[model samples]
Target: MRFDPQPASYRPDPAILPLAPWLGDPVEAATFPRHDLRFRNDRWARAVGLAELSDAAWVDHFGRFAPLSDNLPQPLALRYHGHQFRVYNPEIGDGRGFLFAQLRDGDDRLLDLGTKGSGRTPWSRTADGRLTLKGAVREILATEMLEALGVYTSKTFSVVETGEELVRGDEPSPTRSAVMTRLSHGHIRIGTFQRLLVLEERDHTQRLVDYCLEHFPGPTPPEDAPDRDNPAVRLLHQVVERLADLAASWMVAGFVHGVLNTDNMNISGESFDYGPWRFLPKWEPGFTAAYFDQQGLYAFARQPEAVQWNLGQLAIALRPLCDAKPLVAALDRFGPLYTAALAKRWCWRLGVAPRGEDADARLVSACERAMREDGSQPDAFFHRHRGGRNANDELAEALQGYAAVEDEAEYWSDDRPETMVIEEVERIWAAIDRHDDWTALTGKIAAIRRMGAAHGEPPVPVGHIRRDRT
Candidate 1:
């Protein structure tokens, strides 16, 4: 493939370095035993102007952790504290991953190339910094499927098998090892701001807020918002808006993120760090993704509450910079925003034109009732009743006057829609682990993309730069 020579292509912009010692620490990549390039996202590569690299070059950068030209001279392990399971922990940070590179995408949106299993940093504590090959494979599947399902998520840009045997309590011991790279909108988390708050670094917190507002532009705060022009208030407003929609998107896609901690919650509102995530088999409210989540803290139906709570933590973090009243007001907007977003996204998945919020809400409720009563999986339910074609009494009434978005895509004619439940994921991984086959993974990706095409363009994420929604 020919590399695009446009200036926007390969534009390395390491914007985080200026935040220096206070933000993170410079670190070295681990010396791996071998480098085997496994998965390369050529589609996103072309979008970011890295499509021209050969397999060897790809491994050199992602596996060996070589610095991208014009990017950071070395990897920087970010520092942030988060509330893990409602308990505040100041010890956690980027123990396993670091920001490898930063650049703009084709749309001029800033993106970060961050690594998982690259190496240990100052935050390594008592854990190995390497990722299991199975973990890498799971992330690839999670990102691909979530993207197709219209969830704003980090893209698994590249995966390289680092020849190493690692032991873990959760998986089989001495399993295969690999390093995966995530291409995301930004790596700034609510915990990033929380770190500053803990240190009593008011100026640094304000600077970080300014950086986020400038880099990830969002809609201006409402005219009635207290301190609407204040950087801290504006940033809070933006994050609240994006995350409300994010929660709704996940709900519509039948996804349970499993963890919604402050550090895991990206400031840009894109979902990342897919650990123990799952899609619903049917409409089960208490379904949890992580096996250890015994309390069902981040269950399927409770995701929106988890997100709203995280946003509240962010507001707490920002109190040092702005008045608490304005931040509280911004946080209060989450409910309305989430309600509207759920209606819109739910309608999108059903392939019906959305009416006003009240009508759309009724349609969503009816569909959920039908699925729960019929014991139908979400993937099957949506596909079987697209445009209200096969709806029952309640759902049919709710779908009245809602014209279907015109599309002749063959995926719409399929007997069943593609799903990424645990069984299918394990089966795909079994093929890769036993026979060293990648066809199953590749084929599933292709099918998922076709499904996304039939759904058309996803709604533009809030706070993202305006562009063609179609």
Candidate 2:
């Protein structure tokens, strides 16, 4: 648990592009000699076998910003552009970040590892490449927590604080600097593909489609493989599926991304960039954490819709690659996929069988009504510690009561918790008393409570929860 402060060798990969004429001079830095960061705790990192990368010799061989000489990633800097919130921004891509090149672990799968705020690049338009320490810290926290919660996300490899200085409007005085690196499947974004397509460069678009299909591989199910010469149709379907699944995950977790801009949407569909994200303390469809989301474009409950909108942009970007019919078909799957995903996740959260065909639609609509009148707080919540009752039964009853109470009261607000809140939860479950199967459901519920009450030592990973069915 102690901080290891001994001096250590440091280095960066020298095989990198020099600063463009417009960019500022590069100031060199290194990861603190000791793997002093919390997430990279010498122990946990070792458990993950990342400790091998922590070795100083390996650092020289692998890290671009590691202390010592200049050993860096194989290929660096991906060139691309994006539309920021629907506005064209011709200049974008790793302005303060660089892909140090992909690295293979024991599995032989190459992981695209990269550093953020590692000094400036040609794209460093009007900004410093130095990242504020706090920004890096927040990113680490977000990644670790998300992974533990069962969401696929980028993982923080390391963060080395540059004891020196930089100024930023968002933080306190001259901010401390740090370089944060993330392990991702790849950095290709919807914007990366869209940028060239916007330039009307068909040849480049074709190449981009090939690259994405080979790497990101969107949703082309086996039977509907795209025409080989026609990679666009393939790429279109792939992205649509990934995007739908990603939206569903966000919905299940009650997360508001705050920004659903195309530039932030990755082709691989993994959620990246945690800026301005907030998890709902309790479910409320209307709540948004991103301060700039004035229009609620990326509201808590509208995430699926927001992602679909971003996918529509991708649809435009890839339009050159596919026929109109297939493109239409790919886009059409978004709604159903998102709905199905939501139900699957909701069912898991409640520990019950998925519902009747109309159940999901009705629940969502009911929540909409309750959100308006009952102060959008969730009628029921997920218990991470399992062994509780069947979630569906408990929640359905609670919601039924809550809605009845709201209707009887004849007035409501989505932002407030009223006298009816607790009453309704209790009122709704009374029906469980009549069911012959209630005993079994109640046993599961009681089991969940028993699990919750046991020593509150942190849970083992959900993957460890029970691979075998109960």
Candidate 3:
């Protein structure tokens, strides 16, 4: 689709005041010889009031080095330390990218415009902070697929091809280069809080907590909640709940994040920093996405544990401001929360209204057993058996009391499910690499959207059976 050349309708509204005091060292974006704007998300742009920008203006704001009006005058490379694969690294931060700007979305939620492969910062330890065009494409695919599957993830706002040849050991040497931006709810990570603890900045930690509570507030705590008045404890509970839902969402979608480091865990519970991510071809607990994850530390099954561990680190960072008992209690709720979330999401993916807690649990177990016995891919399995219609005897029996929530659609008539396997992704990239062909990529995105629409929104778990239950 072509971008509209009209003047932008919406004015810029910056809301990053809470982070002003703690802003890190400012940095400049790299001056690329080429600024080829390849992709622009018009849907998201409209939501943010930037849909009407002319092509040149779009490139100027996203591609060129020009800063957004009323936004940050200069990019701020945030400071934070994280545990990479279980090892604490104090020398970590936004080495290549920085927080470019913050704006309110249609929902009035604060959204951050963060860059990847922009340029080097003080944290760029001996490495060039460049993002390959292939990496940017992969990120776009990852975020799009995850969003269609109902996962809370960042939107790949724009990808501009930078005129530079980058040599990397991963893919072909001297690969094409690009810079991308992500629109996320917030970038305040678990490691962000950890940095305050590392610096012994108790006052700063309190300020950060208040900022999050005000800007990135989560569900309100129960009336009987312990230390509910304390922003630290409240943030902890909210984060735990969000992370638990995230873990369950991944499981239902058959996605492996590959990297579950503290820095990658956003306070808003949205998934970002897509690297070495994968959609499982089948139900395998020990499946690992990244080649470097030989030990499967963040394996498919271990993701929950990994995220919980990261939460523990966040709790540790908040220890100075809140009691330990309340934090531990919050952490302990992960399992139950994950279990409940999985059941609800599973029912949604299957196009079935949840029967009840116990019945839905039994249905989930039955579905898993069927998939394992049949050796079917999760995507295909879910697509074929939506509403528990085309299931085997066991799954059929388990889903007997539940009814389908979605009506028949064109996507349901397709011979195969739309999947983002490695092979398919490579093929799409090959078309782009050999010849600047975006047809395949665009087509795949359309198919994925169709599937998402066919599945419809998740049904609320009502104990009473629907009259339409077949």
How much lDDT does each candidate structure score?
A: 0.88, 0.54, 0.83
Looking at candidate 1, the ten consecutive residues that score lowest on lDDT are 1-10
Give TM per candidate: 0.97, 0.69, 0.94
Best by TM-score: 1
User: For candidate 1, what is the TM-score?
Assistant: 0.97
> Candidate 1 — which residues are off by over 4 angstroms?
1-8, 461-470
Residue-by-residue lDDT tens digits, candidate 2, 1-470: 11211222222223223321111223343333332232343322332244656445444423345432233323355566676666778777767777764433332233456678776776778987767666665675555444433355677766655554778775566856666777666677777777767678777777666655654533344476435245776676667777776687677656667888888887777788777776665657788878777888788878887788778777788777676666666778888767776665554433334454477556545434543554433323343212223324433443442211011111111232221122332232333323312343234333322332221222121221111111
Give the lDDT ranking, best first.
1, 3, 2
Tens digits of lDDT, candidate 1, 268-340: 8889999899999999999999988999999999999999999999999999887789999999999999998
TM-score of 3: 0.94
Return whichever of 1 and 2 wins on lDDT.
Answer: 1
Model 3 C-alpha lDDT per residue in residues 129-185, reported as the tens digit of each score: 999999999999998888778787888999999989999987898889999988887
